[model samples]
Target chain A: MIQSFKMALKSIAGNKLRSFLTMLGIIIGVMALVILVSLVSGATGSVTDSIFSLGSNLLTVTISDDKGAPINLQTLNEWMEKDGIGLIAPSGETSATARYEGNSGSVTVYGTTPPYETINGLSLLLGRFIKSSDVDNHTNVAVINETAATELIGYTDCIGEEVSLDGVKFTVVGLLEDDEKSLTAVFGRGSVVAYIPYTSLMRLSSEATSNITSFSVSAETDMATAEAAVTSLLMERFDQDDDAFTVSSRDMLEDAMSDVTSVLMILLGSIAGISLIVGGIGIMNIMLVTVTERTREIGIRKAIGAGRGVILQQFLLESVVLCMFGCAIGVFLSWAVLRIISVVVSSLSISFSLEWNVVLIAVGFCFLIGIVFGLYPANKAAKMEPVEALRYGG
Target chain B: MIDLKNVSRVYQVGSGKVYALNKATLHIDAGEFVSIVGPSGSGKSTLMNIIGCLDIADSGTYLLDGIPIEDYTETELAKIRNRKIGFVFQSFNLIDKLTAEENVELPLIYRGVGKAERKARVAEVLERVGLTKWSHHLPTELSGGQQQRVAIARAIVTKPSLILGDEPTGNLDSKTTGEIMEIFRELHEQGNTIMLITHDQEIAEQASRIIHIRDGVLSEVSI
Candidate 1:
């Protein structure tokens, strides 16, 4: 058995070009499998992290038209006072240019109530968060992220300083810090985030109470009750016969993202698997040709005492060796590509992780492919009559 | 000793049956140097295959050392081939990827010899064949005569009772053929049973007795 295996290995190595070509299919298949799974998981990880940071207990309520455009906040506010509700935040987002002295930069202005900061997991790097008094008093105070403060005020003191938004001055009350590098691009222009009183923002944007962009709500203790209360409240507020608003908890959002990623990974993996099948066919074809070329050798080996099992083992081992070689190359290439992608998308929280389990699965698949395809040729080689094989090319 | 009461092999070729061997009967005791000589398609190679346990006769009985051949399964026959028989081919059918020593180690490997013993026996066989110096050289790297010697070394590595040669010197030059025949003569003198198959009368004459076949039927021709 050992002798047969050694001979098979030698025979495969004898034809370097053929062996390499046979491995190419497996290489591509494994590479595709690794890269696709890595990318999908990376994206899913970042998204899930982002959603969790938004506070799992909190739910966002947006008053929107049938086509999903924001509607009146007055009606949304009336609905929030319903039974089983705890807290509701009507938030508005706007893009505007902020200038301090000569330097000017684009900033995303999030106008909301005081509860918005706590609900969204925002931390003040300097000064204080927006207070209830600020909303009531319609204060012209602004809390800006480190990026916005830096861009608008340079290295100068930002707290108590005034930053002009489209020539309208507002006093900087606090500085906010970004959680991850990914937050900058996802939130808006770079890391520029500014928070102002909702009343002031509504006055500045010149919109009526009808323009309620979004609302963030938290359930009152019981989850089942919260779900039922929120759904019914939204239904009643919208005056619709059916459910209209998209109300999802943190768990639901995470699950949806996970499902999407799983499907994407599977699709990509199947595409890679197609290449694996092609690779298996390549192995089969080469092995069959090898069996033909070594017909006389096969006969001699059989005559010298190699049985059907030994012959089968030899051919099968040759194919498996080819696949294993390809698997190594493919894994290496996938990791290299993932590394390059990681470097390129540094700001997106994208990371590629190699799963050894996946690699083991790939190896097993390669072996199976080899054995499945190797059966026919190996059987043919084993069953060859010594006399006929000896006379084959004589 | 080898015995054949009656042996026949019929092959399916297209729509009709082709009889490769027809009701052949032969016998040889241990230590006999014999030859089966016939033109191509004359059943000499087929008879050799049957004798080597590489193929079974279609009908009738064959006994090698008093054991029935037809009743043995392919695997059992493989064990017999590995244990009792060695074969040298006309083309010097050595594995191209293996060194001469490795090729010699093959049969022993199938016999489940330990690595150390297999290596020692392979070395002994290579030395016996006078190719110990080329033990590390692959078959393709060696001359045809050297490769044939390696094949001979491989065949005898396991110390089998019989050595089956199918036109073993067909690919060698006259000098190399003479050299191989000399090795065969030494082996025969050493009490090793040899069955040489050839179409060449010159080669057949070197054997102690010649058995001829024409159109799948045996005929005796004394040399």
Candidate 2:
């Protein structure tokens, strides 16, 4: 077997250009498989990380129909005191134009109470989040993100500065720190955003209502129990109509995202696999030519006492070695390609790296292809009659 | 020792049967230097192939070293060829990509010889053939005589029982042919069984006994 491998290497080395051209198909196929799958997995990983960074223990509740029992600030406070529920914050949002001195910019205004900071994992760089007193007194105060502060107020330290929303004045009491690794940072790069007390938002924007339609709840312990408690509460509030409200946890979103990405990965993988099959066909084609070209050599070996099995093994090993070499090169190139991609998307903080399993799959697939495609030609060479083969091309 | 009884090989030439070998019977004792001289298409190669275990006769029994050749499987025939017969072809059929030493080591490899012993045997045979300095050169790099010498070395490397030469010097010049024939004469003197197939009357006269074939019939000619 080792001798056959040596012979295979010699034959492959004997025809450098033809061998490389044959392996090029396999190389491209493996590159496509490894790079595409790794990119999807890397992107999915970063997205999941960012989603968890937003707080996996948090549940988002949206009420399509409040029915008769509309949730208010008092009701949210009461729900927070319930079992498995750590904190509950009523949230509503509206797009409004904000002006400070001569600077004006459009911003998304999220209306929520103090616990919204912890529930959503938002941190303030200056001042404080909305206190319960602000929500109760309907205070005209707003907390703006770093983008809003820098864009509208021209600086982050502009705390206590007055910014007008649709001609209504509100004091900017806090500035949010910028988190470039967050999902919002990636999807909402240049957008200005602000947070105000839910009561104040209801008063300032015509689209914002006193009835809470959306809210976020953070679990004190197990998320499943907390989700169950919230669902039952909504079910009771909406007269046992489960469809009146939908309570979604971060786990659901994470699962759905992974499912989508996995499908995408398979789609990409099989498409690349097709190219690999094409490459295998290329190997078969060249191997056939090689067998025909070296018919006399086959005859010489046979006449010198080589058996059919030995001849078959020699040709088969040659093809498999060719494929494996291509696979190795493909994997290395994929890693380099991923590195280039990582550098390109460094600002987004998503690093693309080669996954080991994908590399293994590529290698295994290449080996299989080698055996599958190399068999016919190897068998052809093996089954040739020694006398006839010896007489060939004389 | 080799034995054949009523051996016949038939070929279908467009719905017509042509006998390549026609009920010919022959025997060669151990250590005998024998030659079969025939014209082209006179079944010289067919007889050589059957004797080499490269082909099976359609009808008849061939025995080499007392084992029936027709009863053996393809793999067994290959083993017989590897251990009992060494073939030297007219074209000096050395694989172009392999070095001379490697080509000489082919039969030993098929015989499952250990690497060290194969190397030793190959070196010894290369020295015997007066091509030790050319052992590492490829067939394309060697002269016709050197290439033929390498083929002879390859044939003898396994120390096989019989050396079958099918027109071994057919492509060499008269001087090279004499050189190759001298090597055969030396091997025969060393008690090796040698069978040389040739069309040259002068080369056949060099053998201890000659068998002439015409139209697939063999007749012994005392020289």
Candidate 3:
């Protein structure tokens, strides 16, 4: 076996250009496999991380049809006092043009009560979130994230600064810390955003209503019980019509996201796998050519007492070694490509690293391809009659 | 020792049957240097192929050192060729990629010899063939005579019972041919059995006993 391996290496080394050309298909195949799979996994990982960062025990409620029985801040507060409910924050959103010292931009204004901060896991960089008194007094105070602070107010420490929303003045009480890795940061492109008291938003924008159509709730205990409780409450409020509202927990959303991404990963991986099969065919083609070219060598070896098994072993080893070489180069190139991608997307904070499982799959797949593709040509060479082979080109 | 009785090899040519080797019988004792001479299409190669265990006869009972050659499987025949026969071809047939020493070690490698023993045997044969200094050179780097010497060393490295030379000096110049023939004479003196097949009268004349083949029939000629 060792002798066969040595001979295989010698033969491969003897024809450097042809060997490298033959391996190119395998190299490209492996690169595609590793890079595509790793990118999907890396993106999925960051997305999942951001999802979990939103708070795993949180449930979101959206009312498509209130059915003449709408939820309000008072009702949400009452629900917060019930079992399985930790905090309830009723929210509504309206886009408005905001101005600060004549510099104006369109900003999305989220109307929510004090419990919104805890439920959404929002962290403050300065001042404080909306207070319970602020909601009751209908105080025109706003909280802005880092993007809003930088884009509209020029800095993050803009607390106590008043900004006009559609010509109505509101004091900035808090500056929310920016999460570049958040799904919003990835998809929303850091747009100007603000959070104000729900009552204040109702007074400022005609589009804002007293009815709370959307709200988020953090579970005090298990999420399933909290979800069931909220569902029952919504069902009772809507005359037992479940279609009036929808209650979905963070865990369910996370599972759905992963399922979609995993399916995407498999689809991408198989596409790359097709390229690997093409690469294997390329190997088989070259190996067949090599066998024909070295027919005399086979005859010589056979005449000197080499059996069919030895000849088969030598040719098979040659192809396998060629594929493995291609795989090694492909893996290295994938790493470099991923490094480049990571550098390019560093602002999004999505680091694309080579996943070990994907690498293992690439390697294992390449080995299988080697054996599967190499067998035919090797068998052909092995089965040649010594005299007929010798007589070839004599 | 070798034995053959009524050995014949047939070939299908279109719709006609052609006899590559006719029903013929021959014998030679151990340590004999014998030669078979014939023209291009007179079955000299067929005779050599059968004797070298490369091709099976259609009808024959041939024995090599008391073992029946016809009863053996393909793998067993390969073993017989590896253990009992050494073939020197007209074109030298050294693998182009391997070094001279590596080429000489081929038979020993197939025989499953240990690396150390193979190396020692290879070196000994290279020294015997007077090509020790060229052992590290590839066949492409060596001269025609040197490559033929490497092939000869490879053949003798396993101490095979029969050294079958099928026009071994056919590609060499006259001087190199004379040198190769001298080596064969020395090997025969050392009690090694040798068989030389050639169409050249001068080359066959050098062997101790010569056999003539015309139209696939063989007749012994005492030299």
> Which candidate tops lDDT?
2
| DockQ, each predicted model | 0.68, 0.77, 0.85
The best candidate by TM-score is 3
lDDT of 1 by residue, B1-223 (tens): 8998779999999999988898999988899999999999898878888998888898989999899988988878989999999889888888766678878887887778899898888888888889989999988899999999998998888888899999999999999999999999999999999999999999999999999998778877676
Which pairs of residues collide in candidate 1?
A61-A215, A72-A210
Candidate 2 CAPRI category:
medium
Please list the residue runs of candidate 1 whose C-alpha ends up more than 4 Å from where it truly belongs after superposition.
A1-5, A65-86, A181-190, A206-213, A219-244, B10-20, B38-42, B200-202, B221-223
Better of 1 and 2 by TM-score: 2
Q: Taking the tens digit of each residue's C-alpha lDDT, what string does model 3 give over A1-394?
A: 8888888888889899999999999999999999998998888888888888888879999999988887888898889899988889988889999999969998989999988898888899899999999999999999998899999988788999999999999999999987665787765463578999999999988766888889998888988888988998998899999888888876887889989998998899999999999999999999999999999999999999999998898999999999999999999999999999999888777879998999999999999999999999999999999999998887
How high is the DockQ of candidate 1?
0.68
Candidate 1 structure quality by residue, lDDT tens digits, A1-394: 5555666677767788878888898899888877777777777777777777767568765444544434554554665577766666678877778888888888878788786777677888789988888877779889988777766788535799988886778999888886663445543345677898887787767552436657787766755667688778667656753445777777787788888888887898788888898998988898899999888778777778888788878887887777788888999998888889888777566566766667777778877887888788888888877667766775
Residue-wise lDDT of candidate 3 within B1-223, one digit each (tens)?
Answer: 8898899999999999988889879998999999999999899999999999999999978889998898988778889999999999999999988899998888888889999998888989999999889989999999988988888898898889999999999999999999999999999999999999999999999889999998788999975
List TM-score (chain A only) for every prediction: 0.90, 0.93, 0.95
Indicate the docking level reached by candidate 1: medium
